[model samples]
Target: MKRIGMLTQIFIGFVLAIILGVIFGPSIAVVQPLGDLFLRLIKFIVVPLVLASLITGITSLNNVNKLLSLGGKTIVYFLATTFFAVLIGLAAGFILSPGKGVDIALPTESAEKAEAPGITETLLNFIPVNPFESLTNGNILQIIFIAIAIGIAITTVGEKAKPLADFFEALAQVMYKITGFIMKLAPIGIFGILAPIVGNYGLDILLPLLKVILAVAIGCLLQVLVTYSIAVRTLGKMSPLAFIKGIAPAGIVAFTTASSSGTLPVTIKNTQENLAVSKEVSSFVLPLGSTINMDGSAIYQGVAAVFIAQFFGVDLSMGQIVTIAFMAVVVSIGAAGVPGAGLIMLTMVLQSVNLPLEGIALIAAIDRILDMFRTSTNVIGDASAAVVVQHQENKASLAKSA
Candidate 1:
């Protein structure tokens, strides 16, 4: 038989896993370790991949001003898209009202409460007290900070830094090669990760929350299809269809994994190779986006917050809606790229608007399914942002030449 493509293989595995889970039920739990191993393998390379790729990308810029300009544009695009994502989510929540008639009893386990740190503290935390500690802790923001600092230092030191820069450049290449080897195992990994989820949760758990799930799904689709498309076409001057097709590989992996961070290697590869975004751009934009961009998470938060409020018959004032919107944007920035990180941030968003924290129990069961779609959307947003930024840079370069 002719060999199946990787994407096709993953789809088949996903379908089979779900079917087996449904037919065999908890007996399929035996496959859970396969999934855990896959996750562990992905997590194994993330810190190093990010650290090496980021430092290499920054040093390659060779100009401090360009680095700063790219950073500014990337952040602007991220924040703008994120703000729009929140609005879209809120609109979907209001219209769909997923929480209406959700009569499920709140779980007996109390919701874990975590206070949102002050903005100043968040900013300060970005700078690692000890770079080694940051790496050991897998503190992504701190690692990015140290990487940028080291990259800039290499640039400032001029000729003296070339050897170090060259070393990291080589390191990045090796890491990419390693990533390629890891991705060859993606089909198996995806199967391992998804099988247990299907087996344990099954369709029954998802039935009651179907409306809320559908609302969040639609909202995420809108952000990815409509919002990002408009930005790419109008600002980036690129065909959105082409953009979407190019990033599909990464999107597939993201959906299966439900992890932006775990899917980083694939995202970076697709953005660089398929999307034709420059390595310098893809390397910096994607890793940073993975760390900070939470468009999908922001949307989920908006939808969930409203869903919970409506479920409890708590009337939200106009001011409260505005607060939720603002909180969605803020909390999303702090959300890690791991699976279910968005749910953790949801607590902060709920608390901001004084929604019942226990309301989380209502939808916790189906979060995995919801997370798959949201993570895919998040990866698409990151890839799209990189393309848009690159397009603008080319336009500026041409204008300067003309």
Candidate 2:
């Protein structure tokens, strides 16, 4: 008898979820607790995993210049690829015209408008007044800041910091063990998580917003298939097919969870095992990308903005379209890497272009469906960045050896 591959089992789980959900309908909600347990297990790993992995990753660097070089390359990769992501998103919007002849009734209550955080305030928030509080609060950006600062300080202290570094390194190993156990439960968790969603979101609810869904789907597909493929190949010097296959597990988890941040551990694990990224690089790049590189959300915001404008019969000016691109890029980079970031980005983009905020209500109805698609894309983009930067680091290491 042949043993089934892990991805194959997961695919089976996904297929079963759809089949059962359709047959059982809303009754499938009963299994949600199984999914919640899995989510809790994963969430339990997130804080400690991030803190320990990042701290060790930094200490391994052993020098500021190397750390700076890695950070610079990671940031540049994010910004450059994001430019193409936004362009692809906009192209999807223009071609699809998703809003044409579609009428979405705004909720009786006004859609809540989201306030964009100021750059200064957002940057300042990164520095945690109490690192323990940040950890307890699960503030990822603050945690990253804490980990980097501590890691850098440890690097400066040399051998004196060895005890602390050893502690974190050990902790990182323990977290990895825990993640492995949790991931074995993935097929079951995925079944539990997806069945209810499939049961709840009937075709009737999804039919009207079908175009909006298609536009976002097409945009995300292009970003992954086109943009990230070229990136991992030309810049990263890896086969695109291999890159896609290596990252598939992370993408599936992201789609089910609809959370790039929550899927960080899987991303790290996939890169290390499947993509050959070093622990040091994956730890830093994947975490930072979770918070900073929101290519998927940017795509959703782009398509939604165009849909809103067209739905209202508002003709978006050339300047407004450019502004949408600018805001999508900036707000995406600036977003706090939380669940509702898509709405926040959309609100800011629409407001900047003088489109009505009420359009948000229409999209909010089918937001979860859109989220599944975007979240998968976001994780894939995150992994691609990890691959590209790690490839650069590998090249640098080879050059040094030579």
* Clash total of candidate 1: 1
* Candidate 2: stretches off by over 4 Å: 109-111
Question: How many residue pairs clash in all the candidates, one count each?
Answer: 1, 0
TM-score, one value per model: 0.96, 0.97
State candidate 1's TM-score. Answer: 0.96
lDDT of 2: 0.88
Query: Over the stretch 86-116, how does candidate 2's per-residue lDDT look in tens digits?
Result: 8888889889999898965777765567676
Candidate 2 residue 377 C-alpha distance from true site, Å: 0.9
lDDT of 2 at 198: 92
Model 1 clash pairs are 35-192
User: Each prediction's Cα lDDT score?
Assistant: 0.86, 0.88
